[model samples]
Target: MISVSSISEFVYCPVKAFLNQTQKDNIQTREMIHGKLVREIRRGYEEITKQNMWSIKENIELEYIFSTIFEEVTPFIKKVSKKYSDKYEMDYSVLKDICNDLEDDLKLESQFLSLKVKKILNTTSKRGNEIAEMFFPQSLLEFPLKNEELNLRGKIDKIEVVNGVYYPVEVKTGMPPSKGVWLADALQIAAYVVLMDYELNKEVLVGFVDYIKICERRPVVVNSILHNKLFGVLDDMLTMFEKQEIPEFKLNKNKCEKCEYMDICEYYG
Candidate 1:
């Protein structure tokens, strides 16, 4: 069974997937630290948003909403700071400085949350609210897939129903809309769409890439072109997996510099 992440690894360089699956263990490099930090921040934001819904009440003011988000994120901010301290081997003083900087940044984040809430309320589409609501909803979080042989599964961040159309959202903490479409992310979202479609028996409208760092949301229309491409990638990966032929690394110099497997990569061209 191939995972969406495995498909992305194959796309990055089949050799990466080959080495990753075959190797007993791999060392963590600096690049992995950055990836971890980005993931932590993304989770922090999600928690903040989840807590906001509970704080809402009749005739609630915008300030109250902003405050609730801010307070909810305080513990998370401290937790992230402690994680950085432990992982980076930084002293307490350095950690304090970093936390202070993050606190200052939270002000801007509060404003961003306010804008998001206003935008959701003003828009005729209920997609944003539906997506937000899904985070804390127990029924939605329950695993929706049961077939094990299908070789694909993913938990969508949220699903939005807009004008009778369903769209899935995936959040990221990295720079908003980085260069080139990320094949891994595409496959991940595709897997979610496929699962949802299987359960609902309807075509999902689209998927969204929400980059919290840059405060931008990009739509990824999952048309037949994308669907075919994803399937082709998946089929190729499954065939390779069955054959047990480890692929050769096609190293790109720029990517290798930031890859976690750089130390062990034989083809660091």
Candidate 2:
């Protein structure tokens, strides 16, 4: 099965997705490790916030909300940082330093989230409890979905149900572009919509890319244009996979500069 995420990877760099699947050895880099730790920390914060949402008073201050969430996530950072440090053979001290940096980053994220919460409550005509339920609709985290007909499968970061409609939400760890989402991200969301359609047996007209770094949700319309583009990429992905041949692509100096498969791609050349 072609993983949904590889669709985005392939869009970013054709060879990247190929190498990701073929490379069996587990190699860890500082950036990769740091990224993993950051994501874990953010997930911890999100889980805590969701768990405590209803319990929080409607009149709660944004700072109070942020502080509460941050406090709950503190131990999570330590636990995961230690786990990754040992597994990757990195110094625990270095990971601690990274965690220190993350403290600032996560603080900013929580603030953004808190502000969003406030905006929703203040602007909406519904009661505070109704606003809470609407803003944080019933959602499933890391929901597994698949389309056997398309031979595509992956987990949506969150599946939110609103007014009897299900929307797929893809959480992105990286910083978003200045304007809209990246092409890869948009396509990935469309791909998830396709999977949701298959799974739910109902047309999913929209999806979302949640840029967690800045706490922004960008909607993706699952229209014909996106469907055409998605199928085009799917064709290319399947062709490359079936032939077991690396497709020719101009090396992106910036991307290749930090790519884990640089050596392997160079070796192939």
Candidate 3:
């Protein structure tokens, strides 16, 4: 099966994707390490959020919400910090610094969510369950989706059920674009949207990319154009994989400069 991540990587750079398919060794860097830390923390946060979402009261105060989020995520923060520290061979102090910074970030996110929830409560006649469904949305974390007909499969970061509709949410720890989502992200979400549509036997018109760094949620419409592009890339990727052929490099100096396979890529180019 063609993985959704491979589709995004192919969109980012076909050569890089092909190399990744062939190569097994992981080249970890500071950014990669930091990304792992953020992903682990976010995964735990989502699990806690899903569990506590139903218990939230409609008339809950913002401070209460903030404190609840903080308290719920505290043990997780320490646990993830300690685990990363030992695994990465880092000092506890350094992990503490990262945790402190994340605390501020999560606080900002909490404030943002609390305000949204409060606004919904004040403006709408919806009760606690409705409000929870609106924001938290009974999400499935790291949900695997597959479509045999399309020969594609992937694990979405989160699949949220809102108003009886399933929407794919892809969490991005890296920086997002200034406007809209990155093309690679949009394509990734589109692939999941297609998979979800097939799996649920419903037409899912939209999905979301959650940019964690900026706390921004950008919607990606699952339109004909997006589907066309996604399928085109998938076809090319499949052919390349089958033939074991190295795709011609489309030179982007910026991307290539930071790419781990840059030295090996020169041979093909």
Candidate 4:
């Protein structure tokens, strides 16, 4: 079964998808290296901050939220700190120092997280859309979705439920545009929309791209054109995988410049 992420890599560059999927050995790309850092920085953001979302909606003070989070998540953080320390071969003291910095910063970070959630429910012109009242989509996190017929499967970042209607939401730690999301990024959310339509039994017309860093949730217009593009990519991937055939390289200098496989890519042209 192909994941939404695998499909995303394909969209970035077919060879990137090919190398990642077909290679048996570990090929650490720039993305894989940085992905760890991103995950480490967000250690307690979603898992812990999400627990306080209700209080945030109730107009709870930021100070109160900050204190409550440390009180509640200390034990969890300690356990995680142990694992992270062992993996990185660092002393527990080193991990604790990093955690302290996170503690100092989370006061402001928590507010950004809450603001992103609010912008989603309360429509804004961030994405050039207009509305009076909030859409109030119930935030569903780490939801698993699969479409067997389409051979599509992945764990979704979030599924926003609005008036019993569901929409796929893909959150990013990276910076976002003042408008629409990137094509590769949009395609990932579009895949989730497809899975939500079939697996969740919800007719979702559109979805969102929650740029967590900037606290902006850009709406993704998932129409037939975008949906067809997603399927077309998937079909190509299926054929490549089934026939054990590697796809031809599409040389776009900008993409290859930052690719993890740049040094090792034999098809560089």
Task: Please give the CA lDDT of all the candidate structures.
Answer: 0.64, 0.77, 0.78, 0.67
What would the per-residue lDDT of candidate 4 be over residues 1-269, giving only the tens digit for each residue?
77787787887787777777766257754455445544555545555544544334333444554554445555555566677666656556756776675555555665554455445545533321111113334677778888888777887877766677777888676667667898888889889888877877777778888775665788888899998999898999999888877787658998888777788788775
| lDDT for predicted candidate 2 compared with the true structure | 0.77
For candidate 4, give the lDDT of residue 233: 88
TM-scores, all models, native as reference: 0.70, 0.85, 0.82, 0.70
- Listing every candidate in turn, what is its Cα RMSD in Å to the true structure after a full C-alpha superposition? 5.0, 3.0, 3.3, 6.7
Itemize residue pairs with steric clashes in candidate 4: none
Q: Compute the lDDT of residue 128 as modeled in candidate 1.
A: 38
Best by TM-score: 2
Ranking by TM-score: 2, 3, 1, 4
For candidate 2, lDDT tens digit of each residue in 22-110?
A: 56246555666676777777768666666655566565677776675456666777788778877888887787788887877777766
Model 4 weakest lDDT span, ten residues long: 124-133
Question: Where in model 3 is the C-alpha error above 4 Å?
Answer: 24-33, 49-62, 88-97, 117-130, 257-269
Global fold similarity of model 2 (TM-score)? 0.85
Task: Give the lDDT of residue 266 in candidate 1.
Answer: 77
**What lDDT does candidate 2 reach at residue 252?**
72
Looking at candidate 2, the ten consecutive residues that score lowest on lDDT are: 123-132
Say which candidate scores most in lDDT: 3
